[model samples]
Structures are given as C-alpha cells and as structure tokens.
Target: MAILSETPELPKAAVSPQALVGAASPLWAYFGGAAATGLAWWWMTRFTPQNLEAMFETAAVAPLKAVEVAEDAVVEEIAAPLQAAAELVPAVTSGTIEAAETVEPVMGGEAAPLGPVAAELIREEEAVQAAATPVRPRRTPPVPPSSDT
Candidate 1:
C-alpha cells in the first residue's frame, strides 16, 4: 500500500464563543442570588433564636407554630380512615406461623424445637465442608524445569 502525500492540509475544528458566553452572563445574577440567600437566612433566624439578641424575637415564629399545629390536625384527619381500616383488618405475620410450625417434629418419631434442629443441621454441614478443605490453584514455590542444550 502507498502512503498519502504530506502537503494535504487537515480541516480546521469548529470553535465555541466562550468569551461571548461569559460576557452575556450579567452581574445582577450573582447579586440577585446573594440577596435571595440573605433573605432566606434572615427568615430562618426569625424562626430560630441564633443569639441572646434574637431571644426577644418570638412573634415571627408564632405563625410557623400555628402552621405546625394545623399540620398535626391535618395528619390526624388524613390518617383517621386508614387507622379505622387497620384496626378492622388482621395482622398475621410470618413469624407467628414459623413459631407455630417450630413446635412440630422436624425428624421422624420424636418432636424437636427449632434451636436444636438448626444446631444439628449446622454440625452435619461442617463435615461436608471439611471433606473438601478447599485449595486454590496457584504456583506454590514454583521451580524451574531442567532444560537440555
């Protein structure tokens, strides 16, 4: 295969106007954000006593306290029907069934509790684990093979 000529100039890449983007962003954006943040902080301080100077300013938080009281009333109102329905329905759990079943015999002839049966099963499983004594396929003190010239 023949190589291409070096005189052929490569096409120029498209460029973004980053300076125009930066210039288009107004100074008011930062000042507006700062002003909004300051207002929010002031509002928060009105609700919470930040220092000894703020302890006297409890009147503004009264409206927020009223809102909290209304929220509790609304929650009780919303949950009333759900609470009534929950009381009417049964709450049978899986643990209840498991506890009931655990009293029955796991093995033949004699009945056993869950604790002893689980312990016996675990003890039996250890033998299966011990039979393997798992070995990893790795170079254990690798030796060089003898080579003939």
Candidate 2:
C-alpha cells in the first residue's frame, strides 16, 4: 500500500450566514449572560425585597422554630407513652396489679441540676483537652529508613 499525499484533504461543512453570525460570538454570548445576570440581580433586589422579606422572615424562622417545636413535642408525647409502657411491664410479669401505682415520669422534666463547681470543672477539662490536642497538619514529615531496628 502507498500513501496518497503528504497533506490530507478535509471535508467542508455547509454553513449559513445565521450560522456564521452565531459562530463569531462566544465572547458576546458570555458578556450578554453576565450583563443579564447583573440586571436580574439588580431587579430582584429593588423590586422584590418587600415581598421577599415577608416570605423570608416566616420562611427562615418558622421552619427552624417549627422543627425545634416538633422535636420537643415528639419528645413530650413519647414520654407519657414510654412511662405507661414501663408501668405495664410490671403488671405483665405479676398477675396482681396495684391500683395506685407510682410511675416515675420519663420526660426528664427537671433540668439537669449540676453544681456550679462541677460544671466549671467539666468545662475546664474540656478546654484542657481542646488545647492539648492539635490536629496533624496536611503535609507528612519525611521518614528516614532504618537499616536495623
């Protein structure tokens, strides 16, 4: 087999004037996009703040507060059920059930009453631990190989 020529002939695609105009313009397209984005941002800030704030205040605060409230409500609701279940266990084991059973509430209703000194000591220990331990830096130190242990 023999090679046809040093230079290879390339096939040409048929392009129109509209295509040529479209082709001349990657820069223009990028600039137009940037300009349009700026304009949109300006427009949104100017025209949309009142409506946005009304939505935003409720939108931001409500969900977070709602989530917290929901979590608290769930905990509150589950506690009574759990306490009742715990009380029932004793009844199941022994056939004789007391009419006036004193079931301890499960909600941990009382705030943890840690002494000020104890709380301070715990905080100090945590601070010491935080200070003592430094995270290892990204770059590893080069290790020299040993000939013998």
Candidate 3:
C-alpha cells in the first residue's frame, strides 16, 4: 500500500449568531440567577433582624457595664474613708470623756464641779440647738453724733 503525504481537510461548519446566542442564553441565565441568589443570601445573612438586634444590644450594654463598674469603684472609695472614720470614733469618745473629767467649770467666781456625763449632755444639746437655729445678720455700725445738735 502507498502512503499519501497530504492530510485531508475537515469541512468547517457554518454557525449562525442567533444559534450561538440561543445556546449561550441558558448558561448566562443560569449563572445570572445563581449570582442573584448568592447576593440575596449574603444580604439576608448580613442584615438579619437578629444580627442587628445583637449589634445594638452589645453597643448599649458596653457603656452600661462600664458605668456600673465606675459606680462600684466610687462607692468603694467613699466607703473606705467612712470605715476608717468609724473605727476612730471610740478612741475620740474616750479622749473627750477623759478631758471632760479633768476640766473644772468656773461659775460665779467659784470652781464648779461638773460630771463628764453632764458635760457631754450639755455639749450635745448645744450642738443640736446651734444646728437648729438660723444665723442672724450683722448689725449696722453706729453713726457719729452730729456736731450741731
């Protein structure tokens, strides 16, 4: 058998533009529909009511929690000083009593003997009276006597 050197050329089929468009239209529609569906799904997940509510709740709660913590710290700071003052109350009371016992009252040019209890009661009463009473305004200074009277 003799081998032919030339290769046979295949017939080129003529394709119409309408047929090409018709064939690709379904694929374009499918891809476009898939893209639209994917976009809708992303939008729904990103802006869901639950997601929005949680984001707002976190924003609201963070400041409230910080305020609560600051309030607790302020209360603790105030209480520490008050607690220290309370502990000193007994010592101060005993010292006042000791001073009262040693001090003698001068009444009508005579040394009057007064008890510590009586002194403490008088001091408390005076304090209460002073607190209850309102302060008086200052009096105007007296004018000089006129030269021609």
Candidate 4:
C-alpha cells in the first residue's frame, strides 16, 4: 500500500520532430520573425544619420561650395567693368577719326597714328587692368572639422 501510494510511476509521453512541428504553425513563427526585423530596420534608419560620420562631412562641404561660387561671381563682376572700359577707349578714339574722315575729307585721307596722349591713356588703362586682375591663387578647400572623439 505504501509503494502504490508513494511510488507509482506514469508512462512518459514521447515527442517526435514531425509531431512537434505539426503542433505549432510555421506561419506564426515567420510573422513574428518579420515583425522583429521591421522594428530593427525602423530603429536603425531613425538614428543612423547622427551615428554616421559621413553626414557631418557632407554638411561641412556645403559652406566651402558656397564660398567658391561667391568668389566666382565676384571675379566676374570685377572683370565686366574693366572690359567695358577697355572697349570704350578703342571705340571712342577710332570712331571719332572714322567719322571725321567720312564727313569732312581729311588731308590726304591718311588716318593719323594714335597720338602720345592716346598712347599714354591706353597704357594707363592697361596698367589699371593689370592691377585689377584678380591675383588670388586658387585656394585649397578648407579641411573638414574633425569628428574624431
């Protein structure tokens, strides 16, 4: 009676792989796995830019590009005035002589060589242009700020 009451053993159930597989649906396992992957992707995309050094590098380059574009525009503006002035000198001097020749026949119809005054003015204009020519050498781009910690 003691053995029957205290030591009776029940037969253990055996589990086979196929029986275990049939018990649980594969679809639920796949859905849970997919959900976990999606959550991970969302988290990484949300925080990836701050964590990556390349984003800061790209930001740093933007100012340098702006500076380069501004420099080009400044140089162009400065050159335009100088070019106009240079053209005016030739046109004014030559156009006057040509007009004189056509309207009132000049002596022997030989155009006078440019006078010393004209030569001096041309020289002065050229000197001014030489001085105005932008002497700035192409500058190397500034180094990006260090992100190294």
Candidate 5:
C-alpha cells in the first residue's frame, strides 16, 4: 500500500532559448530602448556648456589662430620705440658733493648709510629749511612783583 500511494515522478520539460525572451513585444522594447538613448542624448546636450564649446574644425580654426599671433606681433612692433625711449632715460644723474650729512635712524633703529649725492642733497635741504625758519628769542624769567605795589 505505501508503494502504491507514492506516485511516479514525471520527467522535466525541456526549454528552448527562444522561450527566454521578455514578455513585452519586440517593437515596443526596441522603441523604449531607442527612446531612452535619445532622452540621455537630449539631456546631455541641454545641460552641457553651450553645446560642448562650439566645436571647431581644423581648417577653420587654423586661420583664426594665425590671426591671433599676427595681432600679438603688431602690438610688440608698436611698443618697441616706446621701450627704447624708456631705456635711454637714466635713473641717476651726476651731482657735486659739497659736504657730508648724517642719516638719522628711523624709529630708534640702526641708521642706514646714504650715498654721497644723497647726503649732499640732504645737507642742502637741511640748510634751506633752517634758513627759512625764524629763530625764537630766549625766554626771561618774569620780574618779581614790586614789594611796594
């Protein structure tokens, strides 16, 4: 009775590769994939900087680059004479030194040495300033009030 109660097992059915395809129709699936690709392309184009920097072809870009270099050359040509004139100007001129002047220390710090011309100029300046200022008379003690008053 136990053997009869146990049913015989049936063989498993074989599956073909074709049976693994998605349930959606082929046309709809293809269209959905194409739509997704198109959407990604549109999003990239819309969000990217001015459609990816206005791409230039070699033929058109080469001429513009040449013009830029020519412009730089023109500017340098125009500045040459001015630069030559500036170079001819001297930074220091000769001056006769009459006497030496001591350089005062700044903020109680160590004093710095001055060139002969600078010292002479400083001495002349000090002399001029001294001559321009009027000398004040020495103050005398006030006279004591008279005892008789």
Candidate 6:
C-alpha cells in the first residue's frame, strides 16, 4: 500500500517567444492607439481654427520679418561704404580739376606757354567729338550686268 499525497503537483505554464509576442502585440497596439487618440483629441481641443490660423500666421510672418530685417541690415552694410564713396566723388573730381589747372606745363626741359596747352585742349576736344560721332558703313555701287548671261 502506497501513501497518497495530500496535493498533486501542478504543471508549470510554458511561456514561448511566439506566444509572448502574440500576447504583447495587441496590448502595445492598444496603448499606442489610445495615446495617439488622446493626443489628437488634445490637439483638436487646444487648437481651434482661429488659434491654428494665428499660429500659422505667426510661423509664416516671423521668418519673413527676420528675412526682411536681415535684408535691411545687409543693404545698410553695403550701402554705407557706397554712400561714402559717392559723397567723395565730387570732392575728388573738383580737387583733381583744381590740381590740373594749377600744374605748370613743362616740355623740352623748359616752362611751356599756355598757348600750347590751350591748343592741345582744343585738339583733345576735337578728337573726343570725332570719337563720339557714329561711323556709317560705306556703300558700294552695284556692278553692271554681265553682257554674257
């Protein structure tokens, strides 16, 4: 006669990779979907049409304003030196002309008279005028018809 055990040994449940994955997949999907839905709902509640429009306008206008400011700054940076140069041009021109007028003419190791300078200036003016004039193409007379066709 064998002694009878008070409680039978229970079988252990086997956890497999496929079963674990199958069990966890739906749970993960459910939580992911719930989180996505909650986020969407929150987003919809938080941002009304007016709020969205305002946000879009802010997003659009900020960069444009920044670009405009940058453009203005660049233009100012570039224009300052150009403006200074432009301002100096007339002064430089007048100074050059005055210096040219005050310069003593020297030629052939002697002080030359003003007459030659005046004549040279006249010749330069004539040359400038000739250069400014447009040149026309010369026309050639038509050849006579050959006697033997």
lDDT of each: 0.80, 0.79, 0.85, 0.84, 0.79, 0.84
- Relative to the unseen true structure, what is the C-alpha lDDT of residue 117 in candidate 2, on a scale of 0 to 100? 100
Global lDDT of model 1: 0.80
Clash pairs, candidate 3, are none
User: Which structure is stronger by lDDT: 3 or 5?
Assistant: 3
Per-residue C-alpha lDDT of model 2 across residues 43-123, encoded as one tens digit per residue:
888873357777778878878988998999999999999999888885343433442355555775688889999999999
Clashes of 5: 0
Q: Which segments of model 2 are wrong by more than 4 Å?
A: 1-22, 25-58, 88-149
Between candidates 1 and 2, the one scoring higher on TM-score is 2
Q: Kindly report the root-mean-square deviation of model 6 from the true structure over all alpha carbons.
A: 23.9
Candidate 4, residue 6: how far the Cα is off, in Å:
74
Write one digit per residue (lDDT tens) for candidate 6, span 76-148.
Answer: 8999899989888765577798989999996577765679889899999999999999999999999999999
Tens-place lDDT digits, model 5, residues 85-107: 99998665333222223445447
Which number leads on lDDT? 3
Ten consecutive residues with minimal summed lDDT in candidate 5?
A: 93-102
The residue ranges of model 6 lying beyond 4 angstroms of the native Cα positions read 1-50, 82-149
Clashing residue pairs in candidate 5 are none
Q: How far off is residue 58 in model 2, in Å?
A: 4.3
Full-model lDDT, candidate 6: 0.84
Instruction: State, as a TM-score between 0 and 1, how close model 4 is to the true structure.
Output: 0.23
Shift of residue 82 alpha carbon in model 1, Å: 2.5
Winner on TM-score between 3 and 6 is: 6
Question: Where does candidate 2 have its weakest 10-residue lDDT segment?
Answer: 91-100
Q: What is the TM-score of each candidate against the true structure?
A: 0.23, 0.26, 0.25, 0.23, 0.24, 0.27
In the order shown, the candidates' Cα RMSDs to the true structure are 19.2, 23.1, 28.9, 28.7, 24.3, 23.9
